[model samples]
Target chain A: MIEALKQRLSEHFQLTNLTIKNAGLAFLWVEKHELEMLLRQLRDFEGYTHLSFIIASDHIEKNQFKLTYMLHNYDTKHDLGVHVDISRVNASMHSIHPLWAQAWTYQRELKEMYGIDFPESPRVDEDFCLEGWDDMPPMRRDFDTVKYCEEHFDDRDGRATEENRQTMKVNIYPERGE
Target chain B: MNLTHDFSPTPEVDLASGKYVKIWHGPQHPGITGNMSLELTLCGDEIVNCKTHVGYLHRGFEKLMERRTYIQNFPLVCRIAVPEPTFNEYLYSAGIEDLAGIEVPELAKWLRCLNLELMRLGSFLMWLGGASGAFGMSTVYQWTVTHRDYILDLFEEMTGARIYHMYISPGGVRAPLPDGFKDRCLMVMKKVEKLLYEVETTVLNNAVFKKRAIGLGVISSDMVDAYGVTGPNQRAAGYARDTRKDSPYLVYEQLDFDVITATGSDAFDRTIVRYQEMHQCVSLIRQMLDRMPTDGAFHTPTPNVLHWKIPAGETYVKAECTRGEYGYYIETDGSEYVRRVHIRGPSYTHAIAVMEKLVIGANIADVAGLMVSLHTYPPEIER
Candidate 1:
C-alpha cells in the first residue's frame, strides 16, 4: 500500500530517500517548498487525513534539523511520515495550520523548543511551555541541560557532590568483593 | 481535505468595555482535570474566547530522555501520563523493539495486553469519578475511586507498584503473572462490574447528568480528522477509528471485541462510549487470563543495559490508550542515548486546540464537565 502511494507521489513530486520501516509504516523526504502541496494531496486524495504529530530532530553536525510530519490513514491503517530538512542556522518551514487546526499548536511548540520558524502561524511567538525562558531553546542539541541545572539550581549542603550508585555501593560494602 | 474549515479570524474582545470579564479556570481548582489552566473571556456567564494554558507540570521528559540509555528510559516514560502509565511503557518498549528488531515472546505479548487493559480500566474509573464529580455528583466519585483502589491493589500485587508499574520494559515484560492473580483479578472485575451497574443507575440514568451533558460540547464529524481526535472522542463522533482495531499490536488481533461508537459526539455520548469500553476491558482481561500460557519466559535478554546502542532508525509506535491514540516517536543515533524522543499524548490536541475551540459560547459551569468528558491529563501535554 505504501509503495503504491510512493509511486503515485513520486510521479508528481520530487521524492527522495524512501524508507519503509514496516508493512504499515513508511517515511520519505521531500523539498521544503513541495511539502504543503504534497500534504494537501495526501490528505485530500490519498486519505492520509489524520495528522498524528510534527516533531523535529536536531542534527548539529549536519547543521540541519529534520522535521517529520506523521500522517495516518484510518482506512488503510498506515502511517506515512513526510520528512523535510531545513538549515539549522535560520530554520523555517511553511505552516500547515491551514490544513490542520491543531498544526498551529505543534508549530507553536516547535517554534518555542527548537527555534524553528513557522511564519504566520497563530500565536507562534507566544510561549507554549516555558515562561520567561531567557536561555537558548532547551530542546536543541546544543543546549547543555546538565550545565544549566548546575548553574541555576543550588545544591544542598550534604549532597553537594554526586556519586555513581555502583561505586557508592562498593565503597559502602568493602567486605563483599566483586 | 476539501479545506472547508473556515479559519475565521478571532474577533478581538476589548476587556476594557466592562461587558466582558476574564477569568482563569484552573491550575488549582478541583474542577480542572490536572494542573492546567484555561484563560476564558466571558460575557455574562457565556464564554466568548478560551485559551488553554499549560506548562505547570513540565518536566521536559523529551530532553531528559536524550541523556538516558534505552533501558534507563523504560521507567522514565511511565511518568508522561499519571493515570495510565502502561501505554507509555508499552509504546516506549515497542518503539525500541521495533528499531532494534527484537521480537518479543508470546507470553510477554499476552501479559502486556493484560497490563494495558487493566490500566485502561483503572484510568477510566478515575475519569468516571472526575466526570461525575464535575457534574455535582460526588457520590459516584467516591464509589468509582474506591473501586479504582481495588484495581490498584491488583497492580500492587502484580507489578509491585500501584501507580508507576515499570513492568513492561524494552524487549519484553519484566515478570509473569503472580500465583492466583487470575482469581483475585476476576473478583475485582466482578466488584467493578457491580460498581459500574450502580453508576449506570445513579449517574448515567440520572436526570441532572443527562440535562447538563447532552448536547454540550458537541464535536462535529468533520472536526475529528481536522483536529486529530481519536479513541473515544472520535469513536463517540461515529468514526470507528481505534488503534487497537485499526493497527493491531500484541494480542489485540486475537482478542474478540467490537469498536464501540456513538453519534452524538457530546459529553454524554463520549461518557457512554467510554462506559461501554470499560465493560469491554473487563471482557478482554478475562480472555487474556483464560488463554495466556501459564509457563513461559516473559523477558527477552538484550544487550547490556548500561551500554545498549541501537542502530540509527526512527519509528512511531502508538496504541489505543484510554484517552486516545498515545504514541512514542524514537530516533536512535547508534549511541547509548537516544537522539530524539517525542511523546505524543492525545491531550496535547484535545486539551489545547479542541478545548479552546469547543469552550466558545459555552456556559462557565459546564467547562469542567466538558473538559473531563475529553479525559485529558495535563502532565502528558507538557511532558
Candidate 2:
C-alpha cells in the first residue's frame, strides 16, 4: 500500500517529505505544486472514490493553516489521509471539487467557517455561515471565541449576565426570542 | 413494481367542498419525530400528495464539532443520533482508538459490547414508541417509552448523563461498570423479557397495527439496494448485511446472538425486526456478561488526551448500531483536536435519498408512518 501510494504520487508530482501515517492508511506529504494532478490520480487512478472529509486548521504561531484531505478507498477498507499547508496569508486553494462531487458542500463550509478561499470553485455562492455579517471566520484559530460570545451571545434568563458579571458586562444589548 | 417517482409539486385543496381536508404535520408533529414538516395534501381519508420540509432542527453539529475539542465533541456526538447516542460515542471512540494505536483490554471490550447492546435495546424501544405512534397505536408508544426509561436510567447510573453518556472514551470506557453492574444487567434482562410479553400482547399482536404495518410502505431487496436502506428496514427485506456478524467490532464476534431478519419487507417486518432485535440485544448482553472476565483495565493508558496530540494520521472505524453500520472517518495532524470528522451515517442513504424517492406519491396518510417505519433520524441526515 505504501509503495503503491508513493509511486502513484511520485509519478504525478515530486514529493518532498512523505511519511506513512495514521495506521499506514495514507501517504502523507507536503506536495509543492501538482496538487491537482495528485488529487486527480487519487480520484481516477486509485479508485479512492469517496472524499471522506476535509479539515483545515490554523498554526497561528507558524502563520500557516494546515489543510488535510481525508480520503477513502472503495475497494479496500483503508482510509488515505493527505495533508497540505496553505499560507494563512492567502487562505486560498485550487478547488478539488472537479475530482469529487461531495467536496462542494465541504469546501463551501470551509469558506464560511474558516474564511478560506477556494479560488477555483465555481459554485461558491452558498452561504454556510453568518448572514448579513462582518467578522473573521469562526473556525480560524485566531478568531476569539470569548469575544464573539461577549459580542453576540445574549444573557438568556440572566444567566450570562450573572456569569459574566464576575468578568465582563454588556450595557445595552438587544435581545430577541430565543 | 410500485416505484413512486412523479415529483410534481403538490397544490392545496379547497376546504369549501367539505371533502378536502388539509393537515399541517410539521416542524411540530409527534409522528414527524424530529422537528420536520410534512405538508400533506389530503382529499378526505386519502392523501393526494405530500411535501417534506426540513431546517427546523438544524444544529450544524458537524460545524460545532470542528470548534470543540475531541473529548468535548463526545457530549455533542450524542445529539447527532438522539435515540442512540452511545452508538455515536462508540464509533467516534473506536475511530480514534484505531488511529491512536490504542488497544482496549478484553474485559473493557466486552463491557463496550454490553453498553452497545443495551443502547441498541433502548433505541429499538424508542423506535417502537415512535413507530407505534405513527400507526396510531398510542398504548404501545406510551408503554415502550415508559419501559425504555429503565435502560436510560441504567445509562444514567453508569455514566451520569441519562441520554448522552460521554462514557465511551477513545481509549476505553470512562470507568468500569459500577459495582453490582452485572446484577443490574441480569435484573434489566429479566424485566425486559416480562415486558416483552406485555408488548407482544398489547402492541405487536394488535390487529390494527398488523393491518396498517404489514402492507404499508412495502419494499423489496432490490429496492433496499437502490435506496441504500440498512438496519431493521433492510434486514426486514432479507439482506445478509450486519456489522455485528459481517464486520464484528468490539466484543460482538464472541457474543452469541442471531441477526434478526424478516422476509416480508413491509412495515410490519421492519417493526418486527426491531422488536426481535431488542430481545437479541438482551440475549447478547446476557451472553456478554457471562463471558466477561471479572477484572481488567477498563481504559487503555494513553497520553492524557487533554494534552495529547494525535500523531498525524487517519482512521476509519465502522460499527453496527441499532440502525446499521455506522462509519466514522477521522483525520488528525498531531493536534489536540481532530483535523476533520465525516460521519457516513447509514440513515443518510435511507432517510433522504431513499425516503424522498420512495415516498413520492404514496398515501400522504402513510407518509409519517413510512418515515418512522424507515427509522429516519434527521440529525444523521442533516449532519
Best by lDDT: 1
The residue ranges of model 1 lying beyond 4 angstroms of the native Cα positions read: A160-178
**Per-residue lDDT tens digits of candidate 1, residues B292-318?**
999888988887665578999999999
Candidate 2, residues B1-383: lDDT per residue as tens digits? Answer: 22122233356567788876667777777767677666566775666655455455656666567565676677788778888888888888888777778898887787778888888888888888888778787777777787789888888887887888888887888877788888987897888888888888877899987877777777755455334456787789887567677656787777777777799988788888888888888888888878888887898887643455678766667777877757777767777777667676766556544555456556766777888888877677556
Lowest summed-lDDT stretch of 10 residues in model 2 chain A?
A169-178
Clash pairs, candidate 2, are A22-B313
| lDDT tens digits by residue: candidate 1, A7-123 | 899899999789999888999999989999999999999999999999999999999999999999888888988999899998899999889888999999999999999987888
Candidate No. with top TM-score: 1
DockQ for every model comes to 0.56, 0.08
Name the lDDT of candidate 1.
Answer: 0.91
State how far residue B200 of model 2 sits from its true place (Å).
3.1
Whole-model lDDT values for every prediction = 0.91, 0.71
